[model samples]
Target chain A: MTGTELKNVKVLAANIRIDILKMLEKRGYGHLGGSLSIADLMAVLYGKQLRYDAKNPDWDERDMIVLSKGHAGPGWYCALANCGFFDKEWLYTLNEGGTRLPSHPDRTKTPGVDMTTGSLGQGTSTACGMAQGLKLKGSEQYVYLIVGDGELNEGQCWEAFQYIAAKKLNNCIVIIDDNKKQLDGYTKDILNPFSYEEKMKAFGFDTQVVPGNDVEAIDEAINRAKAVKDSAVCIILDNIKGSGVKYAEELMANHSVKFNTEEMVNKNHAAIAELEAFVKGAE
Target chain B: MFTLDHERKMGKRELRITVADAVNELMDADKSVLFLESDLAGASGSGKIQKAHPEQYIQVGIAEANMMGMAAGLSAVGFKPYTHTFGPFATRRVFDQVFLSGAYAHNTINIFGSDPGFTVGPNGGTHTTWEDVALMRTIPGAVVCDAADDVQLTWIVKEFAKSEGIHYVRANRKAVRNVYAEGSTFEMGKGNIVKEGKDVLVIAAGQLVSDALDCAEKLEAEGISVEVVDMFCIKPLDKELIIKEAAGKKAVVTFENHSVIGGLGSAVAETLLEAGVSVKFKRHGVEDRFGQVGTADFLQKEFKLTSADLENTIKGVLL
Candidate 1:
């Protein structure tokens, strides 16, 4: 990716972080770690990589994507809103009663959410099925999945991995956000996954590990994955628990942030202000 | 199960074979028909269709939950996918996915669960599922049907092809008696009255439908009148016919191959309660208990699921 393209993605990712903060602040409490961790990848994919029509969200020829860790729903909704799928004002109504944006990504409720997901490990399997169905119908469409490191603890994810490999669902790409933390604590302290790449390799995936926070790196990794046909690819993203925000990263416990307290509200505003300043400086 | 006396005496085809053949016809006719198997296609007889058309068949190998989510994903993309597995795994193994991913996600898919209740001989408690109907029907907007014969089964498969939303059809793995004629068509949310009598309303589903009819036959010989209703469509419970036909009868007797707690009996009981109709009801089937391995006959006799049991149970209700 060119420097200008990389810079453009960086600006989009920073804006998405602000969107996440705004939504969570309005809702008073929501998943912050997982959503923030995937902002860069979301920016690259939604900003440049994906082939979707904002007007026709169900366009047949477009590539389909599933956010396996659906707690990151706010991040995805922000990406869609910014991309003109809907107005940005909808982000404030998230998690409210009768809101289109629920706590999780629901395809029936949200316009651009291809599949409903919140239950861990299930979305990856659905992605596999979607890719297989498209392949069977002889469509050149691709199915991309983004799963969290904590979410891989679900046996169904591995079940999907084995099935995709066995069925040779080459049209699918599974990106694992190795954020190294779950809702409880650090993933290593909770339940050690050891290495997702080696496990995915053992499960017969064309494995690749890249810096998850780098938009340019993820773009290149996806391009590389696109070239490898006849097999599914698993790209591991080594990102922080809270990628762009220093307060959440310092506390290391912002898995679900509630800005109800004075300290938390101040910290959130400062973080959003920092992101906005970064975007302005880039310009 | 195939249906009707004329078709019955003419060397009837296996019930599962009818499902496979109907699905095969569907695959040939519609490009959107996709089938997912959890390594039981051969056992369920869908393997025949899988062999003829590999493009539409997907074997997820023993991962039933993944098959459900996969089917949900396929449904999102406009493919009308049907997932097949043994009875217990179909509902018990992936109940949450069927609810959240299949139903809540607004994705439409069909699930065919074979070998319900004691009919899964030798595979034992782990394989036989008496709770499938209860669990399946409980899902909001789920179309739950317990198809008694191939005529109903074929109609259901075709109906689901053009229909929308989640559907679950549970039928026997092998042939049983035929209740309906060969070319009979069925609409969803309607009940089929096989025999008409005024003394009692006898409602039944699955393998027990034939037995329920036998009990009704024996009661008729003793100069007692009985009405038989084949409630294939369990959900959208056909309350209109259940009330209309069951009017002024001394009682309604529900017999099923599933547990009496939440299967056909529970549905009928709820209907009777809501309509505020005072009808003495007798619930017969597997009581709240786990299943065991034995021939269908042995399990039926042991579990007190025989026509004789139905006869005694109905007699008790009549008095």
Candidate 2:
């Protein structure tokens, strides 16, 4: 968590924001709030935390990441492209016909995505499974999971939480992006998930609450999770609905939106400029 | 309905017991083969494996969705995982996981969906999965299979152990009437023509194989030449054998222990249509009805899936 590392991760996050905005803007509609909210965490992961070979994406011994809230795929795709998992040119192909990158993460098609996930609760379960599998093989690899706060509405996520703790899958690290917004509206208006830390602890996880916007805290939480031997860790990453983009962040509910109209396109461009200014601050 | 009168339900425990043993042996041979249960180890007749190989058998505790993810995770790291539960729980309960984690990820995990369709009997509509075959068939590259008898079930468990990707193995927990002889070989995606004739083609699967055989025998004795084919592999259907045996026959009657709409009959109808062949065809099974508590005879009479129903359907088609 050095200053240089923090700045580098911040730049990466800012760049991912730009990538996501540009891609979705061109596509005219996509998940914005969830994708933007997770950018910093993805930045810290691909930039400083994860140990992977971009050249050998399928290396047998490499650690894994399954984005259970897979609608945030554009943000992850940006991170992978920045890390050289694939060419950056492929990012624009998001959700298009014959594109490897779809609206959801497909491991078979995408280069760096470890598990295929679009359905909310399924990824958490798969991450737990990967943790157990890696343990059985006696591999020291970690399975990193990024789950959305709203995604917890699916009962499968809780089922996965219980299984991970029951199996004592300490090799897995779950980060809950408590952005507090979903497709319909605010999570409170939809289904109020009061406290993730308490719920996670009840499910037998070694839980922590961290500032989602802080890369240093995210990095530290990941390391802390790795140190625990008998219990899995759940870090509730408290974040703003839209992290860096002002236009997106200003929306009362920017969950999944469209920029198909002329006014929205101008607003999108303004958001891009705002993200660019944020990168200068990182420098 | 379909009745093999003198033959009792003797093979149920024997087959289940043998499966438990085979699973244990497979686990012993390969450290990677992990066995998972959804708190149904006792019901699935694997109490011995539970006691013997405690490490191998993981009781996922009524969490079928999480069980699927656990199996997928185990498969990701090169472990051959066999997830066992009743049919409805395995397919309908956690279908999204089976689709994304299991099939889409191309991870290898053998799912044993025991007690398909009416075999759950008293378990009723809530427990029985008449739409599992239809549901599983929709998944791309998924190997959907239904066991005909004791030998086929045993063989499928062993074969799918080494095969890759998501595979569905649906069968009854009870003893099935043995059809293939000991050491008889079977191929995936290739239907076995158990009996061949010119007048009628009877394609059958699961516990209904015996009923189909009985019906074919009765029809044959009545001077109607009947052919019976065991369509064990339902998804990667034996279209070659289906066309080879069924296309030119006087008529085709498909028998299954599932709904007539999306099970074996639908697959056969779609295949014939795709191949551009016109033939008199009828699907003999539960005619779009929810299951109820009864003997297979009573249920079959209610749903018209018995041998008598098969005879009537065939006669209506041919005569």
Candidate 3:
């Protein structure tokens, strides 16, 4: 990736992070840790890799995304809005009554969200289905499935991984965000997911582990995954729970946080200002 | 209106084979119609289609939840996916997937839930699903149906193929007593008065439709006229027909091979009560009990879903 391209993608990630914090702050409380963790990967997708038409969100020939760990819907929504899939003003309507921007990614209500996911481990299987369907139709489209490390506790993810491996659906790129935190507590305390790399290898996926915050590495990993022939592929993002937000990163329980407190709101405001300035300078 | 066939003999083709044949016909006509099974291809009689149309067949192996999500995914990408599993596995086992991924997502898929209720038979309590209809009915815009015979099962499979939304068809895997003639067609959300009379009305579905017919015949011999209606479509139930038949009748009874709590009986009760057509109503089914290990006949009697039970229920309401 060129320096200009890398810088542009980093700016895209910062914009996504800013939007997510803004939307969550407007809502007073939302899923923060997991959503913040996937901002860079979402940037790598919407900014660089994914083939989609914001004008024609239903474009049949475009690549698709299934955010399986749907608590991170804020991140996905920010990416979509930044890419002009929908108006940026809609982000303020998150989880409101009669709002299309739901707390989870709903394909029926939202534009460019190919699968409806909130229930963990489900989108993995859905992605496999989409990949197999594409292969059946002989279309050269990819399905980028973003799964949370915590979401893997649900056995359905493993079931889907087994199917993807058995079918060798390289068209479905399995991206696991190892943010290491779930709703109740840390994933290691809740359920020890030893090593994502070893598990994906055992499941027959050619795996790659990359720093979650690095947009360049994420882009390169996706390219390598696409180049592999006749084999299932996976990328494990080794990221912190509250990835881009410094205040959220140090806070012990950042899974879902309230922005109602003055300290938290001020901290979020400060972070958003910094991200916006970075984006402005890059642009 | 449905054309009722008075022939009470067994259908030549097993219900599973009938489902398989209809699905095969669909796949043959449209390459987009995919048949997905969760390692129950042989049990569902879809193994034939798997052999013939390997390109259109997907065997997802024992993961019911993943299979449902996969079906929804296939539906999302413009493929009309038909998924088959036993009743419990199809509905209760993966209800969240069916609701959120399939129905809520508007990624519609046709689900064929085989071996409902007593039809599961020797598969025992673990496999028997007495709550599938109730569970399926709870899904918004989900079309739920119970096939009584090969003819009806074939029509359900073919009709739901073109229909949108989450369509669930519950039928037995083995042969069921034929209640409709070959080439007989039925409409969705409509009921057929197989045997009409004035004294009482018995709304029935699934394999119990044949039992209800026999009970009506026996009640007629005893000078008590009984009307038997095949309410195949259970979710968007034939409320109009139910209200019409239930009004001014001496008694109303609902018969099914499922639990009396939330199956055909509950739907009928809700419809009749809401319509304010009050009558001596009774639910003749497994009286809120789990299934047990037995032959189909033994389980039918054990659950009080036999013709004899229907007669007793009506008598209790009348005499």
What is the C-alpha DockQ of each candidate?
Answer: 0.83, 0.76, 0.89
Worst 10 residues of 3 chain A by lDDT: A1-10
Question: Per-candidate TM vs. native?
Answer: 0.98, 0.94, 0.99
Tell me the tens digit of each residue's lDDT in model 2 across A40-143.
99998988988899999988878789899999998899899988988888988888899999999988898888888987889988898888888777898888
Model 1 residue B108 distance off true place after TM-score fit, in angstroms = 1.8
lDDT tens string, model 3, B1-319? Answer: 3466676798788888988899899888999999999998879899989987999999999999999999999988989999999999999999999998899989878999988888788999999999999999999999999898888888989999777799999998888888987788999999889998999999999878998999999989999999999999997988999998888899999998878888899999999888888799998888778888889888877887789888988999997
Index of the highest-TM-score prediction: 3
Best by DockQ: 3
Q: Name the runs in model 1 displaced over 4 angstroms.
A: B1-3, B6-11
Error at B75, model 1, angstroms: 1.0
Winning model by lDDT? 3
Q: lDDT (0-100) at residue B306 of candidate 3? A: 81
Write one digit per residue (lDDT tens) for candidate 3, span A105-125: 998799998899998889998
Among residues 3 or more apart in sequence or in different chains, the pairs in candidate 2 whose N, CA or C atoms overlap within 3 Å are B1-B306, B1-B307, B2-B306, B2-B307, B11-B175, B12-B174, B12-B175
Q: Write the per-residue lDDT of candidate 1 for residues A10-47, one digit (tens) a residue.
A: 99999999998888898899999888899999999988
TM-score of chain B of 3: 0.98
